[model samples]
Target: MATWGPEVVAGAAHLDRPVRWLHVAEAADVGVMLTGGEMVLTTGLLLAGDEQAQVAYVESMQRADVAAVLLGLGRAFRTTPAAMRRAAERCGVPLIVLHRPAPFSRLTEEVHARLVHGRFAALNLSDRIRSSLTTLNLSGAPLQQLLDEIAAFAGCPAVVANLAHRVLATAGDRNSLSELMRDWDRVSRQVAELVRNDPVTVGPDGWIVAALEARGQRWGQLVLFGHPGSEESGRMLGQRAAEALAMNRLLGDRDRGWEEHAAESLLSDLAAGAARPEHLLTRVRAAGLPVNRRTFVPVVVREPAGRAGDKGDRSDKAADKEGLPQLLDRILAEEAVAGLVGSIGADGTAVLLSVPHDQDADAALERVAVLTHERLAARGRRAVVGAGFGCTVLDEVRRSFVEAVHVADAALAGPAATAVARLRDVRLRGLVRLLRDEPELQAFIERELGPLLENAPLLAVLRTYLKSGRNKSLAAQVHHVSRPALYRRLESIQALLDVDLDDWEQLTSLYVALLAHEAQQAVGPEAAW
Candidate 1:
């Protein structure tokens, strides 16, 4: 109390150390009876004339890591002892002395009550945060909502970043977050290094980080930027927020694997239209995909038919399939393309390239295509890559992805000899593939090719003839038959169908029917109506 005229006599620099508790000890060797962080109060009754004991006392206090030593003036020397003060200063332990008589009991009672109250308040705050986050989690709140809540509690920006130091989501004031992100590339690297080296929960500059982990696998980190609170409380908030996120992820995708990479999750959501465009844009930006004045190119790569199991061994096929995403990622990185690459359906990989407005989008796509084909070919796999129209608006990115998927299907169905296939390249075949599910298309396929449906030999000859663009000579060579024999087969087919083979309009109809039939067959027999 001010009435007691308390003054710091030594080690004033260490006054900021936390006081875990208060202790009253008069024994010369009282350090053994106490734990660390206790502020010791004494009258110095035993060490009145012993310098060696005084020095030993301060050394023992230092060893025990006591918070400070407070000496009452009356019973001890009238003023602070030179030996003890020097020793305290030397030990860098706080030493506060009462300039007048002060009651130790009252001082302890007051400080202890305040300490208890503070601890109680902290517990309440912790419980409140935990309950709020738990409720949010149960209600199926989105990841951004959870991050926003955490940011509100922390009074600062919050960031969720993958292991690669890419931000996956962020929350808090836009201006403040923008300031933080302006130098995120450097800050994130430094923070990642610090975390790796020390693994401390509370980092430099009031940054509190908690690892998002489950079952001993860590996928990302939750960071609270510059929390304006005691380190203990900041760490509590961070750990609680991290737990909520991890639980949210676990409950969000329980059936599938929880270790889905961050890029894949974002791309998948974008393609599926499962999340709002604004939300997806936020995620895209946070995921480190360029958004401003950028061109978005959506591409899909499909594995050749029968290539998955071509190795014959199930494990080999599984390994190959798993490496597809990684393979695409490597190519993207090596080519210096800013993109999100991930697996789509069973045999397709999707990539969203963010090209700067100043860069040529076509050139970027061509570079990616060349490397992709070259790398996949090196692995004894030739994949078909289909790219959609490049767009500048983020809202239209999902449409691009859908279009890319269509182009990929068309490429698979038609004769695509290029490294990269676009919508125009697929031409009539692409149109048929896009509308292959139409009832009219199915009916037309049946009406035009119904006569040859059951006759395997004649159907093969007709398909070969149509595919050769009415070239009877090439059709005969392909079927390994004489021209006369091919003519006879064609005439027999014409007689069954009761249609003239030489009619231009009739030939065009048959060609479209073949395209539709092939497209439907590519999807499988179950899709046929």
Candidate 2:
């Protein structure tokens, strides 16, 4: 408008319309040369001096959706024609009059140059955003960081949610999460199924949504508020954000699904011992787990260890590690104590419950462990659930959890294949199991039985003597040897290990060594050295 020194006498409200391109035509059917959003800078001399022709001209430009119409005042019977002005006012199209003749070529050049510049700027901004997010994804940034990048680019709050509309990650200073969470389903339901990279605003507040998808599976959604750029640019930003999120999910472990992410965080944080009880309570509540139970018990369920041939073999462990936690969640839900369950080891899972304090929770916990074991077995999973003692104080639940894990470790390393092993049941075996990793304990086992181990005849006599509680006659009968033969073997054992067979203290020490040796054998044959 300034290039022609024009006056906008009507539809001044539409003057700021974005001009995407500039077109000039002298034909009576000038609308045929125009497209929507193009500023029609034309000298309408061909249809001048005819009111009906002027109306037809304005109506045609209106139909073409041109940004604005500029009429040369002299040839078009200037002085602001009423017919064209009324048509412009009716159609809400900006009408400008060039009082002094101005070349249309210069105006088109100026406006087109500005249009191209604006376009390049938008494209560059979008490219920079995509490159930044792609670089962040490659650098192994977490989901939250990616959301922050989107939020910063969008200049508004951003959130990541599952298809179920549960918020997984949020990035914003003043988030409308509680607001959206109130009517989340309503908003989510309004989103159309996106076949490609289509971003949509569900409502009036400019909440834009994009799908987080890969390999034809939609993992979740990425949403932003008050998206600042054009719809096309916003969509480009959204599609790239989705790709980055999918890449991040592919690169991450365990957090592949938001539910897994929630469980792992809850269990790991509580197991860390430094988490405050109130903070922990808040976390569990946020996870949609129960906190109203009377007492809390920690139980560890493990699939029987795979063949010790290669302890790390992961063939069947996937089923147990993935299935046990899911099963425990279901059982606990039925018991009305469904809460946090986590995979703690390759073949082990842990669950912490909140039960009533007054109830006999120790018995209830035992029942739960038993049911879990049976359920797992029925499912062809053969699991052993080691239950820790019940606790009234929530903070002490972590301690119980530790004890339960220790019990499970001992039970798995012991000869007994009990499905439910309490702390008390693993007593001596537990203590020895703690020392199984110690070089001193292994040395002690090797030192005491060093000489007699290879001499099977003498070793058998010594073992029987030990089993018979030092009753020489019982030892002789069990070994099928004469009293003199047993006595000779015991003497030989005592001399080899430098202990007196008559001394009760020495006998007790040797018995403890033998117990340790048995535990090591139960663990692995190589451990029995």
Candidate 3:
């Protein structure tokens, strides 16, 4: 911005592009003579009367990628040119009018000086942020201290969220942080995939998010609740924060932080009422998880199957597991659900999300689960989100969590369970799972399918036929065999088990036996009832 007034005549939105150079040119084809980012000044020497010529001049400027085009007035027909204004706006090149008969030399000098000063100031700021963060790192400051400094630089609430937008660490005033995080699931979903080292504003609130990445993989995000300054500053602040977080991540095991450990411990204890209600609230609040005050929806995410023995598959699974926490957090934030996510079991994540009371719980959970599956699929990972009960009371949360676990376990049992199942949908399988170790159930399974169990192929054929409800074509298709081949296997199964294939009552008994068998396989033989 030069001291000499250069009022914007059109395309003011583009003023955010910082002017890097200024050029005084009256030639219509001056864009060909300069590099990009130069705010070209013209007196319409060749564009005074011709509208086409003026439009062409603007087009050339656009091609050269100039920040803005200034049209000097008085000599160029007394007033600003309509052709030039429309051209600049149409081409998205800012049009600035020099209202007064100003000297070009002074304007050029002023703009150059300002640009230089701004660059140096930005450099100084980067240095300061780096210095402070480096000092903190060298002194072994906790992660929160680094985040606090970032929040200070941004001048707003700041948070660290796993890829799923689950808040990991936060800084700034508690009230303000709460306000910023409220309905964060929907808010965070508006975020775009951030380019490395580039910060982008997200949502209508102008919140800024930058990737916290290392070794070519992004683990989570650093967020400014509301960036208070120019995009340049936001980018700088985000980059600095990203650097600090990445460095800290390299220096420490972020997943094993005290905060994460504390959350896991708290959630684990909460599942079984290890503490009193009032004390639990205090602990939840201290851990930054909203509880007792909002409608909570418990969810569990787990891989669809156990890892294969292939090295490639194992590596991919490991990567997905490592990324799962971040992914869940990001989803909740994007869904605008006020949620808390933590590690649970060996390869699963758990979330306690707060949704609006009036929100459709089934739709919300389905969408959350669907989107989670979709996003994870984009990274070549298959995951399922099982939903539990939704409740307002803190005491009810434990039951909801337990239900979520049951639903997740059911989904893990087979492909038919779908990626997202509600507690109501999985109750039967859950019950069967719980009773898998009962001697009666074991005896029943043995009586029904014991003779056929010795042959794996025959057992598979029988299970598939039962799964299809004796639909010969579907079972044959599933088994990748012809109808005759499937019938031969069915006859063998019938001969071996001495069961009637056409009897619905016999089919029911066998189905129950198969369920018991699968339940044992799913939980593993060593698993206790």
Best by TM-score: 2
Please give each candidate's TM-score: 0.59, 0.60, 0.49
Q: lDDT per residue, candidate 1, 1-529, as tens digits?
A: 6899989989999989999999999999899988899999999999988899999999999999999999988875887899999999999999999888888899899999999999998999999999999999999887767888999999988988878887878887776676667678887887776675222388777888888886668888888888999998988898788888888887686643333455676777665656556555656767778878999998888876564424556677668767888888888888898998877767888889999999999898889888988877766667778988899998787777777877888776553788889989989888887788799999998899897888879988888888787899999999999999999999998998777899988988888887788778765211121
Candidate 3 residue 40 C-alpha distance from true site, Å: 1.3
Cα RMSDs of all predictions? 9.0, 8.2, 20.3
Off by over 4 Å in 2: 1-18, 24-27, 43-47, 71-78, 96-114, 129-152, 166-179, 182-203, 212-220, 228-230, 245-258, 265-322, 344-367, 375-529
Mark the regions of model 3 whose C-alpha exceeds 4 Å error after superposition.
1-17, 46-53, 79-86, 190-204, 254-290, 293-529
- The global C-alpha lDDT for each of the candidates, from Candidate 1 onward, is 0.82, 0.70, 0.74
lDDT of 3: 0.74
Q: After the best TM-score superposition of candidate 1, give how far the Cα of residue 27 lies from its true spot, in angstroms.
A: 3.3
lDDT of 2: 0.70
Any runs in candidate 1 off by more than 4 Å, and if so which? 49-52, 131-145, 196-199, 245-282, 290-293, 298-338, 341-351, 356-529
lDDT of 1 at 488: 99
Put down candidate 3 lDDT per residue, 1-529, tens digits, no spaces.
3444578989999988878799998877888888898988777778888999988989999999998888777786588888888988899999988777778788889888988999899999989999999899888776777888988887888878776666667787666765556556655675544333444444335477888878778878877877777677777888788888888877776547545754765565544335445444434554666554467787877775443322346776677678787887788788876766787766678777776667776666777788887887776667657777888877677777777766667666643356577765656666676567699999998999999878888998888887776799999998899999999999989999998999989988888788778877754211111
State the displacement of the C-alpha of residue 279, model 1, in Å, after optimal TM-score superposition.
7.4
TM-score of the candidate numbered 2? 0.60
